[model samples]
Every structure is written in structure tokens, then in C-alpha cells.
Target: MHQNNLSDLHRFIDRPTSTWSGRNDGAGAAHRRVHQAVTSLGQGAPDSADAVFIGFASDEGVRRNGGRQGAADGPAALRSALGQLALAQGRNSLRHTDLALLDAGDVVVSSDLEEGQKKLAAAVRASVDAGVLPVVLGGGHEVAFGTYTGVADSRTRKTAGSATSQQPGRLGILNLDAHFDVRRAEQPTSGTPFYQALTRERAADTSCRYTVLGISEANNTQELFDTAHELGADYVVDEDCGVLNQQALLSTVREFVASVDIIYLTLDLDVLPASIAPGVSAPAGYGVPLEIINVVLKEVAASGKLAAFDVAELNPSFDSDGRTAQTAARLIHTVLTYYTPLSSAAPSLR
Candidate 1:
């Protein structure tokens, strides 16, 4: 464990992407954006930053489930796309100069998938202890369980002030996905993360409040729905989150936000329509709009209970012109820009 902890997490870097800035690179130019702006985490890495990005480079879980692979590279692709996103301006009409960013590289997921998740959990706890928001980039939805483990462990320690902290903070998990991902697998996979989380919380005697948005009736089986119902999971189907039923979705989401102390947000790109996000493994036939997605995310961030976040299931293998990566990046950008810590002095800047 010590040796693994000492190693920097990245598994591969195809090449160092350029951070060159152009004379015409205005305040909004993406080429002069995130990649260069986010410092690398290392020996001299800044301990205090607005957010730390942790990547999980593994598709083993997806492969195990016989789903389309390539999500393993989701993090790198996200960085590349995010690098091109304009650094948003603040209320003062100038770029927000207080936001500090760090790239903690990718946590290598080995052939032993469970081992990798343990490492991921450790890394997450370490980051939280250091006091920065950890934005995990996923190799698969399986990353959810690992991320939840990290946050749960950190929150416990935070409240309890010990490794087994019984400090009483509860968690509200918000998943923007098409399927429930509650399949009971002896071996965990992209389809089993939420189920794994539910099991973990039950074993820990901790509260686990869960809600799902954008569920597709045709995609999930009756058994899965039964499992969700039995677990007391709150969910809104794909059609309900669409243009027609916006009011109901908002009402449920508002109530959801008001209920939890801490929020764990996970977004699976497949929840968006194929036309807007065609790069995922399972593209949506009739999905939610980017506008609606952004609205929900921004609202959650505004609630100030968003503790940890992860974006998953981005299969660049099937991407069309990098649309999916861009979409995911946009959501990420929105979170970074909109989230204000319950107690923070200023916006994060490098």
C-alpha cells in the first residue's frame, strides 16, 4: 500500500498536449485554458487549491459486463476537451482569477479491478483531507463505488476526527444515468456501482439516500425496477425529465436537494440524446437536453451540498467529432464555475 501510494497515478500519456498560448488568445480562448491552467500534483504540488482532478484509467469493468469499451481513456479525453473550454468570466466581467486547479493525473486501474478501486478510495480520502474538492474522472461507472467509498471514508473521518469517524454526516447520491446500475454482480462492473454503494452504506450503518434521473423504461428490466423500489430509490424516467414534464422533475429534484447534507453527483454521458452525445457506449434514443442537464447541475451546485463529483462512461472509441467529450467537458465546466463551497473565501484560481 505504501509503494502504491507513492506512485503518481497516470497510466499513459499519448503525448504532452500543447499549452501554447496565442497572441489572439483572448480571456475566453480555450487553447490558453484548463490544461495549462491546472497545475500537476507532485512533491511541491499546492496543497490548497479549489479542486483536484483524479482520473481512473480502466475499462475492465465495462469489458467484464460485455459493454463497449474505451471509457478507460475518459479522463485524458476530458482534459483535452476541457483544455479548449473558455475560462468563464465572473460577475465583474473579468476572468475569475481566484480559482486554483490541479491535475492529480490518472489512478491506474490494473488487471485486478478491485485493487485499483481500493487505491482510488485511498487517493480520494487523501485529497479530501487536504481540503480540495475532488473531481474524479471515470474509467467506467464502476468508478462510482470507489468514489463513494472515498467520500464516505473522508466524511466519516471529518466528522468523527478518526479513521472510524462516526461523525453524523449523511450522503445524497444523485445519478444522471439511463439505467439503475443496480445489477447484483458477484464481481463489480459498470452496471453494479450504485448497488455496491447501497451495500456499503448498509454495512457501515450509515445513511445512503439515492435518486436517479433520466431512467429509460426499455433499457432497465423489471427486476432492476423492483430492486430500485425495494431500496426506496427515487427516480424520474427519461420522458419525465424532458420538455413536457419539466415542472415535475424540478419539483422532485428540489425536494431531493433539500433533503441531503452532502451530495455525490455522477453523470453518465449516455443520458443525453445520441444526437448531442453520440460518443458514449449506450447512446440515448430519446434523451434529455443539454440545457436541462445544465440546469439541474447548476442547481445542485448552487445548493452548496455537492461534496464530490464524477463523470462516467465516456467511450471515446465511438465518439463522433468529439461531441461527447465536449459535452462532458461542458458539464464539468459548469460545475467548476457554478459551485461555491459552503464556506470558502474566494473563487478558485491559479
Candidate 2:
């Protein structure tokens, strides 16, 4: 039944490998890492997996906006970076043996970018159907719409009262972005995802509960802020989101997580400082540091409300020595590892 929904994802995936050289045994277990762990989401019936990854490999939305236009390659760059890390980073134990990650491959996007988003939504819906969380590797921030579509559609299928459950409460959207991305565009672009979401939610009579962190006041026009305000959206500027403000940021995240039944976390690469994540469509000259950003992300992940996740705008074409890809991968790693179920024996459904 899902064969029509998923096109070429299992066939069109990039399998990147990581090289390891060491004692090869008891001492240096270099062979045990992410690359070795991730398997194909076989015919949409993955035998076992904690999270399923789907790549959105189209940059047509970015191209339409005339921004740095190589984010089409972001998915593979993210995979390459993610495949290289140790299964368990030092100072932390990933309990790698307890995790099963599946790489579901990329959505086959053609000239029609909107169609690609639809395909992505289908792929994500399929993953959720299989009792696995979807960690989407995005071509651009435009992927947010598709990601949201999948999560929203799957809400009813979700088990009630669980974090990913579909209960009588609002769905919270938390975007870690430097710009509001709430543009009133005649056509959808990497710059108009959130606005598109808000529009859809309003039309569907879904209560809107959105909060954007790391907003750069100068990067976003006053009109965008006004639109966000009019929509009853909340925000925190870049200056107020640094590592020095950890207490404030965590409190904010905890409060927001408590108010929503489920969370769809979108991490736009541009929200990080240009010095740290320079391979996005637009680099932030003054953005949040990775350490501080991870703190809030970790809190949300462990909160059990995280339903789905998408990392966007990782343009390998603009990266220097793959620093940005690595940063994005690190965030992915943190979220996955930080998520420890309240009762491991009872795997939470997403």
C-alpha cells in the first residue's frame, strides 16, 4: 500500500562509510560506530529501528528565492558527517547496543518542489506508521512544511497520552532559526515555511502555538515581526539566547514543552554563528553557540514531547572542511543520544 507513497528512497540512498584504524578489538573498538549501525528501512518494514532518517534532496525552493542554491545536496552531506562519529562520544554512553537507526533514503524530487514536499510527507508518514520516529535530513528550511504535514497526519495514529500521542491539546512548533521565516510569499520558498504552516493551521482550525528562538532582529524585517505578533507567535532574540543565558533559555523551553501535546523541532542551520555553521543558505554573523543551543535541544528531546525532527539548510557546497555539516551532525547525535525513554522496556511510539 505504501509503495505508491514512497518512491526510490530505499534505492536512491547514499551509503557513506567511516574509516577506522586501531587495535581492531578489545581496546579500540573503532568498527562500532554510526556507519556500521544504520541499516536500510527494508521495503518500509524495518525489522527494528529507533529512528528512521529520510532525506529531502531538492533545493528548488531555495533556488526560487535566489539564495545560495546548493542545499539540494544537504541530505548526503549530513549522512556523511553523521556516519563518521563514534557510536558513543566520550564522556557519554549512547547505549549503542540499545539503538537501531534506519536510513530510509531520499525523496525523489524533480522540477516541482511542492511535489517533492508531498513525497517527503508520504515518506515520513510511512516511517511513523512503522513505529519509528522520523529524523528528516532537509534540503532547505522549506522541508518544514512537509515534515509538519507528516507529523500532523500521523497525530491520530499516535498512541494517546504519550509524548508523540494525539490527545486533546495543541501541537507546539519550536523553530531554532535566525530569521522568522514567516514571509507572506506568493510562492513558497525556503523563507516562507513557518508562515505556510501557520496559514494551514488556521485554515484547519488548529490552535497555533509557535515559538521561534535565535531571531536576528536585523535579519528579519519589522513587518515579519508584526506578522508573527499578529499571529500570536512568541520569540526570543539572538542576544537573549547565548550560553550565558542558559537558565533563562532552559526555563523557556521547559515551559513551552509543557504547554504542548507534541513537538515538531526544526533546526535551521543559519541559527548558528557563521564561524560555527557557515554552510547554510544564509550564515548568521551573530548567532547562538552550538553548546548553548544543544542544551535547549537536549531538554526538548528528553522531554518525551519530541514527535519529529528536521535539520535544514546544510549546504555542503558552501562549507569549509565540512565544519557546518559536522556541526549539524553533532546536533543530530546529541538529540538521538539524549533521548532516554522513561521506561526503556516500554518503547514510546512516535
Candidate 3:
């Protein structure tokens, strides 16, 4: 049965249970893995789940942006990598929780990128309403727009006992990318989602903030930098985001987290060194180190304000020995291990 009336999420194709199968070392929690903890979204409503995984299967935006394709296969490859990982030990282990691991499956995007984004938005909204964190797997950085809309719309819904408090709270978008994707375009593309988001927020006068870390000065044009500056967005160049300055970066992340009521974290894999993450449309020539990225993820997860998250630009066609997908999975695992809900109070469910 459908989770709700959010039909825009056309034909939820449940990924096979075999996709989640992996090493089983015994009956002990110490021997458990991700595949053991996760369950299909169809098993039950995600109302009681801690996190719900949703896949956006499309690379139409990349094509429009004049980049190599194949990121459309990112979701499945990511799942395969994640399924094989060992769970963290001690108190941080997912095996300790009673909550289910829900995979709601892919929102297929054919020729129409906009329509596909709408379907993704619907799926995300449904997951948010059920009080579950939406862990989105992307087809491209274009996934950012769809993910943002869902989280933004969810904040507007009239929840129980908050009819008078329908005012949407501040949203902070923290982008980990090599490029400041705020390009001017006649149509939406991988390089224009942030631009689109900024425009929408400005027109509504919402208190949303967009910040990009790990921006490669060599990759983005002067126009993009000027646009980001003119729009009042904060960003740090890749040179300034080295592992040696991790504390400073973490401080920056913490400050951003404090400023907003919630956070939406989007990672374009191209932000990492091409050697570390080579399976993206535009692999980084001198990207931020993975160690720095790991620390940032820890800070964000511990903040308890992270409402939604997505990893973008994982093009399997260019991946080397599946390294990119594995790295993405590792990052996801780190987030899952450290995430803390906003408060002890029960989340306001729709």
C-alpha cells in the first residue's frame, strides 16, 4: 500500500531484498552489518523509522549541463556498497535500535527532469511527515533542488497543535562541492539548482541560508563567484578546506548549524580528489581531502538539526573499481552512526 496520497512519486519500485544481503558472521550484535539491519520500505510505514532511504534515478540534469552521463545508476551502486559495510561497535551500533531501516526505492526519472524532481519531492515530503530522516541517493547535483523543495514544503505543513505555528522555520543548506553551482541558465541543470533555490528563497523572503564549502577556485568561473558573493552566500575555497584546518572548518559548520532551525546537507562527490572520488561528471583536480569531509559530517550529524541529506554526482561510468560508491557509503555510515535527533521530545508527525 502507498504511504500516503503523494502520488507524484510514481510507481515506487521496491529494490530486491537481495540487494541488501551481505556478510552474516553470527547472531551477535558485534558481528552484524548494514544488510542485516535494513528492511524494505514496503514492510511497514516509516513512522517509527530513524531514517528512510530514497533514490532519485536520473541524470537528465547532467546532460543539460553538458557533462558526461551515467550518474543515473548511482543509487543502486551506492546501495550495494552500503549493504556490505560492518556496523559500528558499542553504543553507536545500529543493531541496538528497535527502529527499522527503510528503503523506499527509486523515483524513476525518464526524459522530463522537472517531473522527476517533483516525484522525488513528493517522496521526501512523505518521509519527512512520517518523522523519518530522508537519506536521499542522487542522480546528479540537480537532486539538490528536489530535496530542498521537499524539506521546505514539509516545514510549511500544519502539524498537530501547531496550526498557529505554521510558519516555516529557517533552513540551512550546506553544500560540499567543488563548484559553486549558481550559474544563470534558461533552464534547470546540474549547475543551476542553487541559483534556482536562491531565487525562490529571495522572492519569499525566507530565512534560508546557502553555504558552499570545498569550492574549487579553478573550477568555477569568475561569474559564478561574483554571483555567489552578490547573493550573500558564504563559501570557502578548496585551498582553505584542507585537513590541517579541519578544526576551523568544523567551527564554521557548527556556526551554520546554530543559525538555522534545520539543515539539509548535499554532497557533490566531485568535491573530493579525483583519485578518491573519480566517478563524477567533473572530477576534482585538487579537491578537499576525505579526512576533512569526514570531520564535517561528524559535526553536522551531532548537531541534531540535520533534517535531510543527499549525495550527488556519483557517475558509475567513470568510477574506478567502485571506489566512489564505496566512499559514499562510508560517509553515509558515519552519519548514521553519529546522528542525533533535535530533542528528546517526540517529533511532530503529520
Candidate 4:
């Protein structure tokens, strides 16, 4: 096994001052401009470029729940963590095959539920239109609706008599979470984005598919599972999949994405065991490991079908010495490295 060192961990935590101005014009500005334009237009910006990283921190429900109270700060904290991965150079320095990437800032979400979702949808749509793939950070898993809505709207425009002419293929969701997130709107908690996505009036026309991985049997409701199955979603439980062994799990994920035109990877941090990711909205005793989660993300990135992504449910209030943020950052760095071109090596960790 590759033993991790304190120096290595520390190297990925320090942020650089050179890239903070937002006018670098290299990959960073080219990345931020799309979100700036979209936010300016009050619409979700289309990702017209090769790849773009966008972050969204929706803290609406944090006030009501003690567990997720600090999720609003997750995006910024994660970005800070990712800066330590040394991504200033071309692709050759990366662990995974390099690809182009940029960091688009967070989307603005209001306190009102409906209005916030609409705003998020518009922002996401704008990002997709710019020809850039969006990698969104989260406020909660509920933001999945907005992220998916934007992607679905983009696919709707590209439909060629039932086929999409996009880089990733037909848009679908690969959600890694402890809960199914299939709760209905009767309660409207943060646990219902997938259900809303499947049951929404226009969902059928959008042709979006969902694959839920790492579900905890203790947390799921039978009715929700039945509904997900009815919607044609592939639900894999933690018990059945054997938590950290991602090879078999990734094979199943690959099968689910085989027919899709595009894939959105959504990670609810609660999918990790409570020991690893304790600062989530819902902490579970059993879940995937940190390193294994990285492998899964690497596979998704390698598949080249990744369209957009979101990592949600991080509550800093429960974090110990920012370990949760640190982990989240490493995951985000892996993602950024996955998309950056191999010719440009990531900056060496300081």
C-alpha cells in the first residue's frame, strides 16, 4: 500500500496567491467568464468551451438542520483545498490523463425554494450553452434538480429525433450517496432531488436517467426504492456492492452510462463512512472509503462521458480541524486533474 505522509497532505492544503486575481486569462479567467456572463444575464450559462468547473453552495436548509449547518462554506473551502494540488501547468503532471479545465464561481441561490431552483436552473443552462462542462460543488443534494435541469434543457435543444449530439452523449445521473434521494415533494426535504427529477412534469421528455450507488438499507424507504426502480434507475446498495471495492461497482456504473449521451456525477459526501466523512448532512456507519472514492471518480473522468458534477452535503460544523474540507478538496483536485490536458502538468505541491 502507498503510505500517506503528513508532508504530502500539507502540500495539497496551501493556496497560491498568483492565481487569485481572476484576470489570469490563462485557464482561470477563460473559465470564470462564462459564469460571469450567465449570472449577468440571469440564466444558466452554457459551457461552450471544452471544460469548466462551477461551484454552488445552497445553504437554504442549513438553518433548520444542525447537521448540515455549515454546507454554505463547502464550496470555498473545497476550492482552497484543490489549489494545493498544483494545477497551474499543462497536463503532463497529472495522475490521470490530462484534460482542459477552469474554475467557474458559485451560483447565487435565494432563500425562497422555488425561486432558488429556477435561478439555479438558469445558471446551469447558461454554463452548458458555453460548451464547457460544469463541475459544481454543493449546498445540499437538493441542488441536483437545478444542475440536472440545466443539463436537461441543454440536451433538449440538441435532440436529433431522440439522440443528442453532445460530447458526453444523453444526459444521465450517477449519484454516489448514502440515501436514494427519492423522497417525494410532500415533505420537500433535501433528500428528494432525484424523485423530483424523475416525477417532474417534463422529466419524461428530457430522457434523463439516474443510477444511485452506495445506498444504505437502514436509511432508505421501500416506497422510494420502488419508485426509483419504476423510473428505470439502477439502485445499488452498499451491502450488495461491498463498499470500497469500486471495480465491480464501476462496471455496473459503466453499464448504466453505456447508452447515455452525457453523465452528471453527483457525490453526496454522506456516501462515505461516518469515520471518513463525518461532517455531512447525514452520517452513516457504513460507506465507501476516501481512496476508493477517488478511484471511482478517476474512472468516471477516464470514461470521458462526464458532463457535469456536484459534491454535496458537507457540514463543516461537524468537521475536525477541516479534515472534511481537506478530503473534499483532494476529491475536487482529482476531478480538475482528470479534465486538464496531459501536456500541462499540475504544479508540484509546495
Best by lDDT: 3
Clashes of each: 7, 0, 0, 45
Candidate 2 TM-score over all chains jointly: 0.86
Superposed model 4: Cα runs more than 4 Å off: 1-50, 61-67, 88-101, 155-169, 201-203, 243-245, 340-350
Q: Would you list the C-alpha lDDT of every candidate in the order shown?
A: 0.75, 0.76, 0.79, 0.61
Which pairs clash inside model 2? none
Evaluate model 1: give its TM-score. Answer: 0.86
Rank list by lDDT? 3, 2, 1, 4
Model 1 Cα lDDT, one tens digit per residue, 197-310: 888788878777899999999899999999999777889898888766766777787799767767788998889999999888678898887887887887776566677789
Candidate 3: minimum summed lDDT over ten consecutive residues — where? 1-10
TM-score of 4: 0.74
Model 2 regions more than 4 Å off? 1-31, 43-46, 89-97, 156-168, 340-350
| TM-score against truth, every candidate | 0.86, 0.86, 0.89, 0.74
lDDT of 4 by residue, 1-350 (tens): 01111111112111211132223244543243222222211123233334444555666654433345667667766655554444344555545323334544555454665565665666566555554556677777767887777776664335412433332235668888888877655544477777777776244555567887788888877887787777777778877656445667767866875667567788888888888788877888888677667766776665655656788988777786777777887786667556532112323321
RMSD of each: 5.2, 5.0, 4.4, 10.0
1 versus 3: better TM-score goes to: 3
Badly placed stretches (over 4 Å) of model 3 are 1-19, 45-47, 90-99, 156-166, 344-350
Best by TM-score: 3
